[model samples]
Target: MKILRKERGGHMLDSKLIRNNPESVKKGLKVRQGDSSLVDKFLAVDEEWRKVTIEVEELQAKRNKVSDEIAEMKKNKQDASRIITQMKEVSARIKELTDKQKESETAAQKIALEMPNLPHLSVPEGMDSRDNREVRTHGKKPSFKFQPKAHDELGRNLGILNFEQAAKISGARFVVYHGLGAQLERALINFMLDLHTKEHGYQEVMTPVLVNAKSMTGTGQLPKFEEDLFATRDDNFYLIPTAEVSVTNLHADEILEGEKLPVKYACYSPCFRREAGSYGKDVKGIIRQHQFNKVELVKFVQPDKSYDELEKLTKDAESVLQKLGLAYRVVELSTGDLGFSSAKTYDIEVWFPSENQYREISSCSNFESFQARRAGIRFRSNPKAKPEFIHTLNGSGLAVGRTFAAILENFQLEDGSVEIPKVLQPYLGGQKKLEA
Candidate 1:
């Protein structure tokens, strides 16, 4: 198991990066000083196996010819024992070659799968998340005249959040929104969907929350992050962690017209994640829940316009927070912090006064044809031109559950009340405040 060092650039590379650069994969293995000869060994084994198979085939052909001679001899009342013995040896040799072929193929596939993707030119060299850069900060952090309350406390007092009831229904790390909280969550969903579809020119869509194993692997979720997903035993389907899986795969194995090069879509769905590695982080609130609602934005664009589309996509996500008057900052994730399929990722972190730090509310990323290649989503430049993979980008307009939590934490007054943001007033039934 060779661990490749993270490379320096502005963006992370797609998983297929190794397929595009075979030498880099070997160099990566060499860097770890892990049996760099395995690649050549596999190739040699494969070549030898092929040669042995051909030899076996030639022997079998001779055996068949001799067998025919024996049959003709038997017909003529002559000896056939020597021909039968030769047939047995040829069969044994064939079996040996067949077994060797299987071994070589298995060994080759094992080595192939272990190869890592090449680091993108834009990905900055870093060992871990600590090296990530803070790109920019948006709205000023609100200064509370008094001590601020955490979202959990504020939500419980206001009779909007019911963790105990949620625990009874599901298990721990789940939340039950009641009355205004429920309404507010729904409003956020509608607001985001409408904004993206009506203002941002995205097509609204609804997708399944449970997807098959192939769908998971197509997005680089399986084979690597399987434990972080909830799988159904009977059908082998896993609950989706984000709408990205479903929306981006809508055109899987299909080719679209060049005119539709940039296909923008917004979807509202309930996302599920096992959060297998997060044992004690954000355990008390909706920030790290087993399930949550989010309005997701996905786009398929021409490779040339992908980076520009990423900026527009990021702003599309930002508009939600801007409308809600949420104080948030945009951070450029370092290579180590980038997700499995993203080349570049921008995380929108909203201020949480109680925690006295910013927390991630949404992540917008440009996959640069990574998912498109896996999913076989392509677009033809002309009616007769060859199809090429389209760049895929997705982001959460906002995670409704986290947005709800942020609102409670950031807008809570000293008197144990939560003020509704002006933009959400209409959706909140004109209610100005949430109180116990």
Candidate 2:
């Protein structure tokens, strides 16, 4: 008898974990404010599939035994037609059961793919962003003698940003950076790339801005967030919302040696998004642009050292702001505030002087094995060892446009001029400030 091979669509959550520790999965879903009933639904389908599989196996075993008996009857030159007919009936039954088994497995795996990753133990439980805990703050908030102007106004006054021209060219939620504004944006991108590659131990990479649907799903962006994405007309390709999508999937369906446990990449790309649900929020500035530039940091590491690597990744991002002398704080995202694929997250909010508050400039996240599992990224501990899912992590080393805005707002002089940060001065040919 030949055993039927099980087919799978792609890598997903640990099926064994879901089957054995169902209650644990339920608790995790509950903590994330997700419906725990999904676990029950998955369990029901999974159990049904298991039962069908067992029945198919039993039928196949019976057919194998009957075939052996028929072979013996033929060798003795006896009548074997009745038993041969019985074997044909058993073969038909096995085929029917096999079809049912495939259907049930597909249904079970569908539910499994829809489920989100479980939050890490260190991730605090909460209902929303308000419950997030502040980890630390860096640098002093710049004190202005007079009321400061917003970055949009400052950019317009200096003749470095043209919103009107941008609207005429590309509709709203887009901007045209003129002269020094464009220079500052370019400088920030280079500064971040250099810092991450030269100092932070990451290899710089350039990736495609347009990716296929599978690439999107690999990074946990599709299947649930299709509305928020910008797709091409004829193809199933999507314009990436962040460099994370492209960089993190660089090692998709790959297996690495144990000696190269932690592989890191820093990529610079122009990101696109539909911003579907964020109406009337930061609509006046490049903060919520339809297209913007960012330097993304991605890491694929062994599971045991992922969290430790997370801290270092965060610090690497923070170092960008520190070098620019921007005041910012790090906040640990609670369960509900955490991203869909992230087990834990830290949002680095930069201080905005005009708003008298902070806004997110970067989000450092540890996806653990959630993304790795989905993308089929694995690593073996030794030559003879079994391959296991590698942990994936990514963060905006710094959103370049936001950094440009922060520099404009935080370093604006009372004389309507914006002082260039010392670190960025060399990149701009030592220009000290931008003035009208």
Candidate 3:
């Protein structure tokens, strides 16, 4: 891997950004170092291509000269057959070189696009999510007088969640929400979206669930994470894993004004994840599933304000759990455990009393310009000034499915009824309790 020299400019294009830019990718090979060998290989291939091109061009020039000579010879009543044979040979050689050059260029492009982005300076280096760091805790964990029941047991006993029937209809990892369970999930979505839009000042948006490959890659979900997606063969569109993909890509290829520095958006959508590698984890409940509802918040801001914005964003997500009276904690993901696109991340984990442990329910990340560069989201300080990539940040206001699960497990009484939180009662049509 060549470590490309860091060029001094108002904008700093990282490896992912350069890979997405054809011209930058070609130029990056000449400077960067981590992947210098790959760059050298690509350069060697390019040099060979240039040599072949020059050779082909020279051969064509010679063939043209020979044709003119052959014409003169014919006009002078002399033999011209030898020149014609040589021209045919030159044309064949040119075709071969052209084909080889085309193959080399295609191979280079594939390799370039497949490379992952480098970890940001602030990101902690780790291999997986388990290596994440615990940042802080919020609200106290509930202590039950009686033995607590898992969400699945409580939900089944209360006649609210039906996993068996859902499997019968849609296969495994799916659940049917009934009675208050269904209403609770719906209320959470509406509640989160309303809070972000009305109080948080985020614009409410609804984006397409199906998007192109570029949209996925722009959000750091492609090339390496392709296995975690569900794709359609027709036009190659994938079902979005979260509304983040659509909302973040809203300004894809567009430049905005600096006055709009902190552009905020809130969205609610059904997310789909293949969960390809997780065969048994969280298989008992909606914690890890194929389809789940989520309310997402995304923002675009000046680079200098990103970290501050990250804290606010995490608080914004925490507010939802707080309002619901759910016991949860904030964990700062370590360098080794952060997602590919995130420079830094904070995971909000809600307590599940039955499991006697906190489980992740929301993830908020400050990607800086990682997603913006790929999505071509930029901003200009002045009308005539050049545009630069804006920093991108996103967090789950709350995962509706998990919120529903947490409420069921944590609020269940000895009698098997679940009490609705005061804040959610209005959205639940004033229902005070979920009784079987």
Every candidate's lDDT:
0.79, 0.89, 0.80
Choose the strongest candidate by lDDT.
Answer: 2
lDDT of 3 by residue, 1-436 (tens): 0111111111123533443454544433322213434544545555665676677678778878888898899999998887788778888987887677666555554444444344555554454666666778888788889998888888898888999999999998899999778888888889998899999999999999999988897887876689999898878899999999999989987899999779999999999999998998888977888999999999999988999999999999999999889989898776556666776889999999998999989999988887787677889977888988889999999888999999988888998888998999999999999888
Q: Which stretches of candidate 2 lie above 4 Å from their native place?
A: 1-12, 58-91
C-alpha displacement of 161 in model 3, angstroms?
0.7
RMSD of each: 7.0, 3.0, 7.2
Sequence-dependent TM-score of model 2:
0.92
Which tens-of-lDDT digit does each residue in 14-75 have in candidate 1?
Answer: 33344354466555444333344545654565466467667766877887888789889999
Query: Runs in model 1 with CA error above 4 Å?
Result: 1-20, 25-117
Error of 1 at 253 (Å): 0.9
TM-scores of the candidates are 0.81, 0.92, 0.80
**Candidate scoring better on lDDT of 1 and 2:** 2
- Arranged by lDDT, best first: 2, 3, 1
Instruction: State the RMSD for candidate 3.
Output: 7.2
Model 3 residue 31 lDDT score = 24
